[model samples]
Structures are given as C-alpha cells and as structure tokens.
Target: MSTVPVRTGARRVLDGLTRPAVAAVTVTVAIGLWQALTVLTGVPSILLPAPTEVAAALRGNRADIARHLAYTGYEIGLGWLTGVGVGIAFAGLMAASRRLRLAVYPLLVSIRIVPLVAIAPLLIVAFGATLYTRVLMAAILTFFPVTVATLDGLLSVPSSQLDLLRSVEASTWTQIRHVRLPNALPSIFAGVKIATPLAVEGVLLAEFLAASQGLGHAVLQAAANLDTPLLFAEVALIVGVGLALFGLVAGYERQRRWSDGTDGLGGFGTRGGGAPAPTPERALFGAVALAALGGSWVAGTVVVPNAAVFLPSPSAVAASLWETPDLFLTAAVGSLHKLAVGWALGALVGGTVGAVVAFAPRTRPVAGPFLVGARVTPTIVAAPLLLVWLGISFSAATVLIALATFFPIAVATASGLTTLPETHRSLLDSVDTPRRARLFVRLRYGVPTVLAGVKLSIVSGLSGVVIAEWFVANGGLGVLVNQGMRNLQPTLTYAAIACLFALGMVLFGGTTLLQRRLDW
Candidate 1:
C-alpha cells in the first residue's frame, strides 16, 4: 500500500538516526559523569580538568586553536596526498616489473623495519625542523602502508583479466588505468585509511619535536607554562581535526563503494573495475614466492660471506632463534605479551563502550567528548603526561597502547551492528528473538568488521608499545633501539628494528591466517 511505502521510508530515516542518536545521548551522560568524578576525586585541574573548564578554555581560545590547526593540517594534507600518489605509482611499477621488485624489495623491507620515530630526529636535523620536515615526516609515515597495500592489491588481480586485456592488446597506460588502477583501488583505500591517521599523528609528532606554530607546538608550549586547561583544549581541538579528516576519508570510501556497487573495497569489475577476473597465470605467484625465498637464502649465505661487514646471515637470524636465542626470544616474548595485553584491553573497553552506546541511545551526547579525545590524541603526545601519572612502567605503556588500539575496533563494531540488513533484523524480530540472542546474532554478522578492527588494533598497539618504550621502558626492543641509536650502533639499532618488523609480519600474518580460518 502507499501508506506502507511512506512508513518504510520514515522507518529508514529513523533507523539511520538510531546509532548516532545513541552516540549523542551517551556522550552527554559521559560528560556529566566526568564532571562529577573530577569533583569527587578532587583531581587537580592541572591533572584532570573538568569538562566545563576545558570547554570554556576552548571557547575562549578559538583563534589559537584555529591558527595551529591550519598549520598542522597543511602538513597532514600535503604529506598524505604526496604519499598516496607516490605509493600508487611505486606500487604500479612494482607490479609491472619483476626485476625492479627483485632488486629493491629487500631494501624496502629493511627500511620498513626502522621505526619512523627513531628516524624522525635525523630527518628533523636534515630538514632543519621546518614545514618541510613535518611534511617529510608525515609522508614517510604514510608511504609504506600505501605502497605495500597497493602492491598487494594490484598483484592480487586475477591473471585471466590481464590476459584478456593483453589479448585485446591494451596499451600500457590503458592497461594500468583500465585494469591495474581499478583493481588496486581497494588496497589503495585501505592504505589511505591507515595512512590518514598516521600522517596526522606524524605531523603532530614533528610539530612537537620542532615547530613554531601548530597544535603540537602549542600543546608543548602550554605544558611548559603549566596551563592545563589550555593544553587540554588544544589537545581536544587537534584530535577533533583528526577525527574529522578520518570521517571524511571514510565517507569518500563509502561513496566509492556505492558508485562501484562494491562496499568499502572498489575495483572488482571485469574489464573496468570488478572482482579480479580469473588470472591465467595463477601459478606464477607460487613460482615467484619460491624464487624470492631462494634468492633471499642465497643472499644471506653466499652474499654475506663475501660482503664487507659481519652481515647477520639468514642462517644467523634463524639460528639466533636458538643460540643467543634470548635476544630473539626475550624480545619476541616481551613484544608479544605487550601486544596481547593491549589488544585484550582495547577489545574489552571499546566493546563495552560500543555495546552500551548501541543499546542506550540516550547516552551518545555524553560520550561525544571522550570519543573525540580518543580519536584525535596521538599516543606519543600523551606519553609524557602518562609518564607523570602512571610512571615510566609497563602499566603506562600498556594503557597508552590500549588507548591507541581500542577506538577503531569500537567504531567499526558499532557501525557494523547498526548497519545490519533490514530483512535480517525483521526476520529476527518476527521470531521474537530474545535480547541476548539478538546481541549474539548481531555480533556474528559483524565479525568481519570486528576482525578487521582487531587486526588494526594489534598493529597500532604494537607501534604504540614501541613508542612508549622509547620514552618509558627499561627494556624491550624499543629501549634497545633507542639505546643503540644513542650509542651510535647502527647495526644494533638495525637489528632491533629488524626484530620489530619481524614481529609485525608475524603478528599481522598470523591474524590474517586466523581471519581466513574463521572466514572473517
């Protein structure tokens, strides 16, 4: 009936508002609680200012926040754009040239192992702590993921598709634009999504290290003057900008999906941008993988024997897994333990907050500020304050790591739950499903996104743990890397970095396999 269509449209509108309505209500309640707790705890404003006080400071200092925001945004925007462009181009080149991949892959892998923070100081010195320095820092932070994601995506395209294009004798440019580019779109977006936050954080880190005007510099200045309210305001503003940018990117991704009849992942068309058509050369990848391993082994053994330095042979690294094994074992175990604890803490906190918001629409308004606080804050900037409060210990490091890791998973979970298909919800409703049953059903439907969030959280938490160690830990790879760099031991520094990358690959690869196993 005409009335039914009208009701359906209205319901869709209401459903669209459901999650946000809940988020808004939650935010309001949270703010009220925060204010009451601050008063009850008698926490110094310097340590934990009331929400009202922070709001007042922000209202009064709009111009200052604006000025710093503009400066920092310029760096984030420029670096992100440049990084994506270069990453796409390089990734394409890698896909097109096996020789180039063979020649440079090892070096690329090695460079990726070095923590950007460790290299940041040297970049600042080289670039003289200017806007250029900040841009370079952000770009460096952004490039790897974009490159790796795009390369993986492009190569993942079905070979049959390429053969069809070749059968038609597509021009090189045509092939790239019509085939590879479309195919890589999802990977590129994945990279962009990952890079967006990192570039913003990197800009802040650079500004904190050295800048005349920017949110990062302002926060440091406020800290130096012991202006807690002002510091919190600036921090809040910076984080708000980051959240805004992140949302912008997500929106773009969604739009692309809609336009392409895909989801967040685009480029799965037949000839244009569709699911990679069957590749004729599927077996090539297996051969390439074997060849790469063989080359790496030979390089480690024969190549190292003739090289100038005592290059840790592949055998040495493998043997180190047992010999001076403590170095490898201790480092691996220490990092893994931190990663596990951080991931678990993040999952629990983020899941609880998200579930509460999903169920309690009225609390969204109260949670607004806290969500922003979580999203915008770079864990690095907060490390100093965390040090003061939690002290330079594992607790502080773990908390910082947890904070970095939690929000994405929470946001993703909330989004997935809220966006479940109407038919599925209606079917459950028709059955008069219990509330607990509904929750489980929703969780099952949302597992893919939840898993993605988990993977992201793990990697981000690992990065946070490393950064925290640089400032706060007595041990761990980060500490070792920091000490090695301080003592001018490039090899040791590289070794620690190598270990970090190995850890990342293991964790990331492991999660991927688990995801596949779980069909997430």
Candidate 2:
C-alpha cells in the first residue's frame, strides 16, 4: 500500500484549465513576453532577435529553407529507418544469446563514449563530406537509445510467461516471437519515438560539422555572416521538423497503445524474468572483446597506407602517453572537477523538473512541449555561441555541462516516478498521505529510473565539458585533442582520445555500481 497527499482543491481547478486553448494562450503569452522584453530592453537583434524578426527571416528565405529542409529531412528519414531496424535487430540478437551480449556490450559502451559530433572530423577525413556521412551520423546517434530500450523491453516478460512457454516445449525463436516480441513492441515503439528527434539532431550536427548542405549549412552561414535572424530561423526550422516528427511518433504510440493486443500479457520489463544469470565468464568475454578491438585498431594502422598519419600506431600512442603522463593526469583531474560541479547542478535542476512533470498533472500541458523541444534542440551547435557569450570562464563551462546533463536526468526521473504500480497508485489515492511522506516514498521507488537518468547524464555532461574545454583552450584533455588535431599530431590525438575514453568508462562504471547498490 502507498499514499501521496494531494492538495486536491486547487489541483481540481487547474485540471479544468489544461485544455488546448489554455496551451495556446500560454505559448502566446510567452512569445508576447519575449517580444516585449526584447523591445523594451533594446537588445541588439544580432544577440537576441525578436520573434517577428525571425518570422520575417523565415518568410524571406522560404524557398531555400524548404529545399534545404527537404534535403535534411530525407537524410533524417533514411538514417532513422536504418537505425531503428539495426537497433531492434541487435537487441533481439543480444536477447537471444548471452555470450554475444557480453562480447558486444563493452564495444557499445566504448563507442557511446565518443560523442557523435566529435567523430565528425574523423569521418570527414575517412569518408568525405557526403550525404552518406550525414546519414551515417544520424543512424548511429539514433541507434543507441533504441537498442537500450528494446533490450530492456525484451527482458521484461513475466517469469510465469516464460515458464508456461517452456512447459509447452516452445522453440526458443517461437517463444521469443510469440511472447517477448509482442511484449516488447510497445516499449520498442517508445524507443523509436524518442529516437526520431535524435535522428534529426544528428543530421543537423553532421551538417554543422562537415559544412554539408541543408539547414545546418544555413546555420553556419547565418552565424558567420552575423545574420542572427536567419540563424534563429534555421534553428526554428530544425526544431519544427523535429517536433513534427515527434508528434507523428506520439500519434502512432497512442494508436499502438489503444490497439495493443498484448496489453494483458505484456508489460514494461523492470525485472529480468528470463535473463541470463550473471557469471564471471561474462566479464572475461567483455575483456576479450576489448582486446579484439585493440587488435583491430593495430591491424588498421598496419594494413592501410598513410593510415599511420591519421590513426597512428598503438605503440606510438602509448609512448606519447608514457612521456606525458603527468600532463594527462592533471588535465583529467581538472576536467573531472568541472564535470562534478556541473553534473551536480544538472542533477538537482533536471531532477526537480522531472519530478514536477511526473507528480503534477495540471502543469504538464504548458510544460510538455517546451521539454520536448529542448530534448530535440541540437545543443551541440550552441556550445560555441555559449563560449562567445560567456567567454572562457569556469562558470560558463559548468553551466554548459549542467545544460547537457539536466534533460536526461529529468526525463529519467519522470519515467521513474510515474511508473508506480496500479496498486500503489490506488492506495495513494485512497489515503491522505503527508506531502513529505509522499515525496520520500516516491523517491525510494524511483531510485532505479533516477539513477538510470543520472548515468545517461554523465556521458552527456562529459560531452558538454569537453566542448567547453575545447573552446576554452585551457589545460584539459580536450585542449590536447584540439592541439593534436590542428597540428596533425596523430600520436598526441590518439593519446588524448584514449584518456577521454578511459575517463568515460570510469564514470560509467561508477554509475553502474551505484545503481546496483541502490537496487540492492
């Protein structure tokens, strides 16, 4: 049994106001306020364009915007389709075999550490600034979340379901198809919905990085030309497309939820009902997979002509690190310090936002669209602008890291808090629980989801910190990376990249351990 105190009177009143008209009014009021603030403050249009200015710019460049938008949309569509297929397939394969999951999971973690935007230079060097490159980035970025969601979904089936299937002597594939897949599809669809915007984000980022065609190019040109109105317009266009896609996904999700034939038999998997038991051999396989990756890296350096210049030998990278161990260590320590502060701030703010979203229903209609927009906004491109505005300061960097981390934590927190069992919800509704008691109770139940969000935020926060360091040109690993790349020093570059990867792994491991401890 559970209880949550609801201040029933005002909440009931507010519920009546959460209609479509109210949302429209809220947004209108917000835009009006923005316009008034800009006009009264006399802020330079270059720094902060009024909404009307953005509208004018949009009107002026409608044709170009439409064409480039179409190009980007095509790339996004292709990438999202391929990524969805691959991610779902990969999750299925992993669910079907423990050994393969052990072998592949480490590689996935390692690959995830490398920010999608950061890999643009390497990709451009290897594959050129082509449409294929753009699509690849979109696909890769979209792949991860889908894979994770699908895997969790597949493992969520009830033990009773598994036992019954086994008693019936069901074939493994048949059991998987009939029971797990049906149960998982809803979860899978949720993943696909969340991933659609990410695909758009990836394509925009690829364009920004490689100066490829589409809205991304428009952003760069606007920024370079000091066309702030156009820049805002481009950003708006990008965000608009992402939101549209999100709306489509949401509609599909609604349809699926209503039509879900497996609703009675399927549920979101929190417990690993039929999952493989943990064993020492799983760790050994992960280690072997890592070793294989290293061997592949070494082989690439050996097999490819002129690869030595770009990829560098592992020995050479090792020697570079060996020679500059102190430098790397100090840089790592400094970066970690900044990352800690930013992550803490992000955790606080994002967690609060998520809690509000989950616990308070009346405020959702007003807040929901903004949250989704923020989720899809290509904040990677905003880093440089942040640097420009805030300058090379620690506070600025910390803020950037916070901005990066908060959204994931908030999303995760809401997910965790909202997933209370029906029994719990019913109990809460039937009793007048104290507010403090309710919050603490929910917090306890929400630990896993909140922790999951915190874990996701670390990678995002690291990316933010790295971008800050890259622009600040301070004594951090990102500085070393930038220096090495600009100078074409492969050994230095590889060494910095290696250190960054190591740092990511440490943070990831720490979070996993913490989550496990809390779960226990």
The all-Cα superposition gives candidate 2 an RMSD in Å to the true structure of: 5.2
Worst 10 residues of 1 by lDDT: 266-275
**Candidate 2 lDDT, 361-470, residue by residue in tens:** 66678776667667766555565455445757888778888888878888788777776678876798789777787777778878977777776777778777777676
lDDT for residue 39 in candidate 2, whole number 0-100 = 98
Best by lDDT: 2
lDDT at residue 17 of model 2 (Cα atoms)? 70
Clash pairs for candidate 2: 156-269
For model 1, residues 1-520, the per-residue Cα lDDT tens digits are 7799999996676566755575665667777999999999999998889998999888888888888888888888998888888977887887677656544444454345445665554455444778988888888888876777676677666788889989988876677777877877766776676667778888887776678999888887877777788887887677677778767876897787823222222211111221123343324544575577667755765654433133335544455444555775686578677767877888899888877776777545556456655765577777656655576788877887888787877766665566567999999999999999998878777776666566666667877877777665557777766555456443455466668777876776676577667553
What local lDDT does model 1 show for residue 35? Answer: 98
- TM-score of each prediction: 0.71, 0.85
lDDT of 1: 0.69
